[model samples]
Target: MLKIEELQKRIDELLLKAGLPRHSVNLCTAPVGDGTPYISFENGKYNYIFSERGYEFFRKITESTDELLYWIMSELAYKIAFKYELENRIEGRDGRRIAFPKFIELMTKINPLWKLKAEDEIKKTLSASPYDDSLYL
Candidate 1:
């Protein structure tokens, strides 16, 4: 299982890698009731809430520190990307579009290292795990 301290450390590392300030975001886990994870920006800080179901899902698939780190970093990428859009007034195609691809593209342009590192980390995690049959559950 991934420890909370370890997760926090990984999150901090990701923030550093993205050139974001440490105080820009807060990561926490709680019983969110909806079984869905969410990110909220308020008071100049981003609150990332990982629900109980999300925690269990990570615990089931993340067998190593690298895998867990990859998972957290990926989520951070999304949150940071969205935060950037909101800050810069970058709107989506239909105003309600997911914009993940655009975010990834923007992130890649901002920091080439992130994409390369994320790819390596994901490849390592997938190779180490081989298969996860609980994806449907």
Candidate 2:
């Protein structure tokens, strides 16, 4: 039930805030779950991980975990997305998804090699399943 409009709405809500809790922080990415999305405080910043418990998410084509994680991220997520201006990164069929590479860059402000670890895992799952999210990935 998640839509790009919804995601943009969430991002817009945060943009109204003007800033985040930490001026110097990174929203790092990793294949923490099976693309379920997770929020964890690591090092000096918070990590917004594309999550899962393993392959359960990969095996089924169910509701979008991206929405679930955004929910999990709560207001802090709003602030981060607001800080990075996630509204600009969203694109897909009817604008329903976020580009993964730019998403990683928005967090780490560097090449998205770290996202590869997570992408590799997601790639394997998508490869085995009937789902082909590469267009959105």
List the candidates' TM-scores in order: 0.43, 0.25
Please give, for residues 1-137, the per-residue lDDT of candidate 2 as tens digits. Answer: 43434544544444344243332322323455545443444343334445456543322122543433333334343345454545665443212123333343332322233345445543575567534346654
Model 1 per-residue lDDT tens digits across residues 52-117: 643533222334555444445566566765765565542323211233444555345435655676
Clashes of each: 0, 7
What TM-score should be assigned to candidate 1? 0.43
lDDT, residue 122, model 2: 39
Query: 112 in model 1: Cα distance from truth in Å?
Result: 6.8
Error of 1 at 95 (Å): 6.6
Worst window of 10 by summed lDDT in candidate 1: 90-99
C-alpha lDDT score of every prediction, in listed order: 0.51, 0.40
